[model samples]
Each structure stands twice: as structure tokens, then as C-alpha cells.
Target: MTTVVSTGSYDYLTSALTTMPTPVTTSSTWPQVPRWLTLRQSLRMARDPVGNLNKVLAAYGDTVHLYLGGVKPSIVTRDPALVQHILQKNHRRYHKSDLTHGLLRYLGKGLLTNEGADWLRQRRLIQPGFHRQRLAGLTRLMRAAADEWVAELAALGAAQGPVEVEAHAAMTRVAFRIVARSVFGDSLSDEELMQLSDWLTAIQLFYVTTIRQPYLRPVQHLRGRYRQHDDLARRLRELVRAAIARHRTAQAAAPADAAPPDDLLQMLLDARYEDTGEPMTEHQLIDELNILLVAGHETSANALAWAFFLLARHPEVQDRLAEEINRELPNGQEVEFAGLPRLSYALQVVQEAMRLYPPAWIIDRVATEDDEFQGVAIPKGSVFSLYVYGVHHHAGLWPDAEAFRPERFAADAQPALPTYGYLPFGGGPRLCVGSHFALTELQLVLIQTLRRYRVLPTAETPPGMNPLVTLRPAGELRLRFEQR
Candidate 1:
């Protein structure tokens, strides 16, 4: 089916395939943007961020000191060296800036917001849940959820006309279903799952709005908007808390011969702290679940939505990928975990899709101690915006960077990929623990969707970027899905 084109270094998790061409200019002195200019362009920057940022980085050097939202003093950089230095090389000298910590007020101190020794402890405790073995156990759940989505398409195709669907909305449902099943594992009702998804979406939209439009805070507070989301957060906790109690009750009441559930929530319950050998407290477990639902759902949903959009436009690529699926899994054979490695082209599609439109477009960090880069002055409280989107699209780094060519990621492509140029998951010890889980699920959904239908493009204008907490399609990304 999928031939290995002379495997070199196939590990995209660590490094990219092709070498970067021109690195953005590096100046001896800091190339900084004026506060007055940044101020004038703040709203425009928010509205047309990917475009505006492209112009800014092209004019200045790779790393530039600019005001975040034209107010907060910060450094925005698309330099891979600076990114590696901050996130990995001299990581001890830094911590996540208060910009990240600010979420703790609403989301609780989960892995996404937690830091220091506590964060490490949490990571260690939860890492086991996403190990190869545990993920294998979860694969069946992912496939089942994908099947449910395809059944929806089956219904649409049966209607006689072209099977047009909004990809973003469709993938959102699929991602949410997989996450819901993986987390609760049949413990939650359909209504409860829908409610949970709604709450996460509403809270994230509210949080992004507050960060983007700081001046609207007083008006929002007067209208009790914050209070409304807080109430939603509280209700979310109650729902999770109830589910946990129900799980414990079910586990306790089950016959000893019956095996326990193999979902993420069970792993959290059974996980004991390394040093203390104690399970996570109820409150902490709930916090972790909330973060899990958000991370597992949002990024994968956006990535899949964009992937289908690309497939619709690139029929040759799609046909080749479908051929791989059909050959390896001839005559409707279901996908197994072991079978995934054979479908290499699908993974490349996912990788390039993410490269073009990374969900976590930017990462924020702050100096815990004074730091220097390439002779720049050491500052104690400097803030940095690691512009991942800028780095991925830098013309200097990628040949025809604007084009979507999955072959660029082929294992045996030309020169090797630059070390720091293709980081989708944030680097260092703080790298996302669920990276493998996300990738496996992404491949599963991609392979399954393409096997049964052909995604065709529509005449509607293409969707623009909605760079929120996650990069999403500005509106519904509609496409025609013809049953094959």
C-alpha cells in the first residue's frame, strides 16, 4: 500500500525532513517596533493577525521587541534559535509568563496552567495515561466515534444530491465525540456530553474575548459576563465530580472478575503520585479532566477540519492517500493500531496541515532570570511571543512555503529539516504529554473519512483565520463530500 520511500530519519516528533533555506536576519542590536506604530495598528493586528504579523516580521529582523496588543511591552520572535534557547536550551532561566497563568482564575491550576514542582508532579502522574499501551486500548473508542461520524455522511449521501457539509462543524462533532468517549467511557449521557462541550466552547470564547479586548472588561463585568462564565465553570466541575463519583461507585460494585474501565478518567483515578503513592485529590482530578477535554478536543478538531479542506482542494493527494488506505485495508478491513504505520502518507498530510495552520499559533513565556540572546541585553522580566505561525511560514525556511505539498515531509526528502523549525507541540520537558494520542486519533479519523467518501471543493470563498486560543476557520468551512 504505502511504500516507504527509503526511510532516513522518520521521526518528525523530534526533527523536520527538509533543511531550511534562508534564516531570517539576525542583528547585533534588538530590532524593535515603536510603541506609537504598534498602538496605531493594534486593532488591525487583531483583525488580520497572520497577514499583519507577516508584514511586521518581513520588515524587522527575526526577533523584534513590540507591544503585545500595542499595550504590554513584549518581544515577538519567529527565530528558531531564540525559540529553542527559551523553550529548551536555557529553559531553567524562564517560566510561562503571567499571560498563561492568568487562566488559572477560571480554569483552575491544571497542567496547561500549572508550573514548577507541582506541574512536574502532575505531568508524571498523567503521562502514563497516554503511553503506547493505554493509547492502544483507547483506539477502539476513537474508531467507533469516527464510525458514528461516517454514518452521518452515509445519511447525507443517501439524500440523492451532492453531500455538502460544513467541515469545521462536522469535525468539531467528531473530535468532541472521541474526547467525550475517551474521557467518560460511557459514564456520561449524550445530553451531559453536549453540555460539557458547550461549556468549554463558551468559556474559551469568553476568555479569548477578555484577553483580546481589554477595554471591554468593565462593561463585561457590569453585565455579569465573567460571573456567567464562572457559573458555567462551576457547573462543569459539578458534572465531572458527579461522573467521578459514579465511576467509583460502578467500580466498587462490580464483580471482582469484571475488569475496570480503560479510559482516561480511570487512569487519572488509578494514578498514584510517584513520591507519595497517593491518588490525585478529587478537586485536582476534576481540574485535570477539564484541561484534558479542552486540549484533546480543540486542537484535533481544528486540525482535522483544515485537513479535509486541504484534501478537497488537492484531489491527486487525496486519491493517493485513499489508495493507501484501500490497499492496506482492502475490502473494508478496519484500521488497527499496528496498521497505522503503513498509512504513512496520511500522517504527512496531517503534519503539513498543521505546519500550514498550527492550532497553537503562538506561545508566551517570561524571564525568571536575566537572559541574553546573540549579544542582546539580558533582562529579568522580558516577555516573549514565540510566533510559531511565522516560523512555519517563513519563506526563508520552507521552499514554496505558501504551497501545501505533503511530499516535503516525506521521510527520504532532500536535506533534513531544521531542528527547531517544525515544532507543533511546544518543545522541552513541557511538551504536550498527549502528543501521540492526538496523532494516532488524527490518523484514524483521516484514514476513515477518506476511505468512504470524496471531499470536493465548493465555489464559496475560502475561510480566513480566527486566531483565538486555538486557530480556527473564521466561519463554517463548507465542502462537498461525495460517497465513493
Candidate 2:
């Protein structure tokens, strides 16, 4: 069993995990599995990634070299030390893999897909926008969105019959609305939000298909698959451009003494490169906005969907959560941004859900130069697939790895996990900029949700995993909401 230790705070818990020694030798070759085996594994991975990864890791140990249907060999690892080595210690020697590079057409060189100096520059300029202080200012906006969702759920419950709602779809709307309002204020219309969400979903599906099935590339090209996605991408870009244009128009019409609203778009528009003193170009801003919209909403929605699904299965835990919310936040009491720290159990539930189903289930990095980890030779240009799901579920690190247990993250019961053992938002310098923002949004939504309703499993409980651009539930997660 994993050992639990008292930690200072969630920030410290995340940033101060156990550290591992850096590798110093580059002479040993990694254990190589046959190409045929990898080919078979890839097929299984297409259908059931978590199962395939679990099997591969169990058989091959921490690291295994396998050819991934391309010229280069891929290194798949579930070892926390190796993960820390690649993602933290010698991170300068690696860049995001070609898989992420493929996303350039859709995401551009924004923070998510950018590399090297540009990435550093963007990270520095945009980091402050997501700082806890700035995020606190947006809690009202987030709570408003969550309130709307709860009200809608209550209405659904009031209808005579038991109401079954798709958890993913419901959470998607809430997450998107919170992100949209936080980023662009009320500039985007409902029609535009719907269009952006639809187009983004389509684009992600196309990207995943093209990346996973390289054999389909030729057929996709012949059928103008690129054109189809490109049209969708263009339309999304136009939506962002329209929002930006509206911001500018509104700014131009405002009185000189009036202050602009403090929001993500305003922050991005006002940010400047520290070295060059140059602001992001209009096109660049659009790319950044698109990245934010896609990243902000999609991953959080997946996590929240899974959280509710887990809660539905474990009504005891759900009841405990509702009890905590009721005891902490009485009737007519609003959960402010500052009050989030009090919702510890609610946060723990979300954290545990993410441990089971991290949206970014696998993170890829390409070696920028020859390197080594524990004598394993890592040649330059090799692709490393850090199996996050494998690590989070590793039997050695997490006892009862497959079980749903929120106490694993409880204040006094939190375990001392390895540095990279639980990377729902990744690790090291490239850690997600929106980690705090995402966590806060999730906690608020859960607080509002449980306060008004008890999430119960429907016939379709515990949805299967659909590993795609983000790890999503296989189908609509149907769950019944019992109003308090």
C-alpha cells in the first residue's frame, strides 16, 4: 500500500513530491520488443489503450522499445524516474513530439504546441493571466456558469419522470460557458459558442484519426479530409477573429476614462514580449485564443464527466461529498473563490477521478539530442511516449490502483507519490499553465452540483474510456439527477 503523509497544501503536494536521481550513463540499449508484437499492440491500442498499455507495461517492465509503424522507434515508459528524467531533469534536450507538431495546423504555435524559445516567451507572457490572484477575480463568472447548470438540472429533476442526462454533454456546456465567459466576457453569442464547440470537436476527431491511422493518410488526402477539417478550422478562427474585432470595436467606442474588463482576452491583448516589447499579432492572438478554448473546455469536461460517473457508482462517497457541501456551505451561502480551500473533499474527488482517467493520458516528447536514462541509450530523434495512465495505475505506486478512492488525496491521508506518479496536468517547466484555473472551475462546479442534486447511476453507468485527443467517455454518460 502507498504510504500517506501530511502535506502543507495542494500546491506543495503537487510541487514537492519525492525526487529521483538523474541518469548519467548512455551506454546500455533498451529492451526491445519485436516489431510484429508492437504492430499487434498498436491495433489493440486503437481500441483499448488503457488495457493495451497495462499489458505492455506488465510484460516489458518500466521501459520498452517498440517501432510505431514509422521509421523511428518509440520508447514507451511507465517508470516515474524515467518520466521525471525526460520531463524535468533533461527537459531541455527534448521537444514535444511530432504528434503534437501535427496539431500545428489546428493549434498553431500557441503555448500548447509551441517549442523552444517561442514557447518560453509565450509562457512567460501569459503565465500571469492564470495566476491564482487573477483567477480569483473570475470566480463569480465561474459560479454564475455553475449556477446556470444547477438550475437547469433542477428543472430537469422537476419534470415528473426520472431525468437522465448525458454527463459529458452537460459538463461540456458548463465548462465551455465558464471558459468562454472567463476568456472573452459576453462578446461571443450562443450561436457562435455552439459553432466553436462543434467545429472543435470535429477537428479533434479528424486529427486523432489521421494521426493514429497513418495508413489512412493517403485516403484522407484523396478524399480532401484536410480540406474538410481546414474549413472547420477556418470557421473557428473566424469566430475568434469576430470576437477580437468586437473587443476592439467596444474598446474604440468606450470613453477614455472607462476601464476595460479584466479577462483572458484583455490580458492576452495587453501582454507583450518582455524581450522585444511586441504584442502578439492578430493571427497569433487567434491561435492562442483557439488553443485556450479547446484546452480550457475539452479536458476539464472529460474530467468532470468521469468525476460524476465515479460518484454515481459510489453513492456513499457522493453522499459524503453532499454532506460536506451542506455542512460547509449552508442555504443562501455562496461559494466564493476564497472559500474553495474549504471544499477539500470535493477537490479530492475530482483529483481522484483524474488519477483514474487523465484526459492527457499520454504525453509525447522527441529527443533533441542523444540521451540516456539508467544506462538506456536514447538516440536523438527518438519518440518517447510517457504513458500517464500506466503510471497513475501502476500497482507498485498506487495500491488498489483501479479502485475509486478519494481519500488517496485527502489532507491527512494523501500518499507520498513519486514525482511524476500522478501527472494529470503533466510536470516540470512545461506544466499546464491552467492547472489552478481548471481545478478551481472543477471544484466550483462540483460544489454547486452536489449542493442541489445527488448524482445517481442510470442503466449506463461507468462509461468506457475513449482515448482520443483527450481521454473521453466512450459514449454519452447517462446519469440520473435527484434534486435535494
Candidate topping TM-score: 1
Q: Show pairs that collide, candidate 2.
A: none
lDDT of 1 by residue, 1-484 (tens): 1111122333442233133323334455567788898999998998988888878776776677888678988888887778889988898888888767877776788998888899989999999998888989999999998988888988876336568899898899899999889988978988999999999899988988898889999999999999999999999999999988888898899999997788999889899998999999999999898888887888899999999998899999999999999999999999998878888899989988988999889998989888788788658889888999998887666767899988888777664565667777878878877788888988999888889888899998889999887889998899998777
- Lowest-sum lDDT 10-residue window in model 1: 1-10
User: What is the C-alpha lDDT profile of model 2 across 1-484, one tens digit per residue?
Assistant: 1211222233432242223222222347656767777776676767886787676656656677777652348888887778888888899999998788887898677899998988898899899999887898888899999999988876775345457888899999999999988999878888888888888888988998887788889999999999989888888888899999998898889899997776899899999998889999999888888888888998999999999889989999999998889888887599988888888899889899999999889999999999987766788998899998888887667768899999888756645554577888888889888888999999999888888777788875467888887889997789888776
Error of 1 at 374 (Å): 2.0
Tell me the lDDT of candidate 2: 0.82
Reference-based lDDT, each prediction: 0.84, 0.82
Against the correct fold, how does model 1 do in TM-score? 0.94
Off by over 4 Å in 1: 1-28
Instruction: List residue ranges in candidate 2 displaced over 4 A.
Output: 1-27, 69-72, 158-161, 256-259
Checking candidate 1 for backbone clashes, the offending pairs are 17-417, 18-416
TM-score of each: 0.94, 0.92
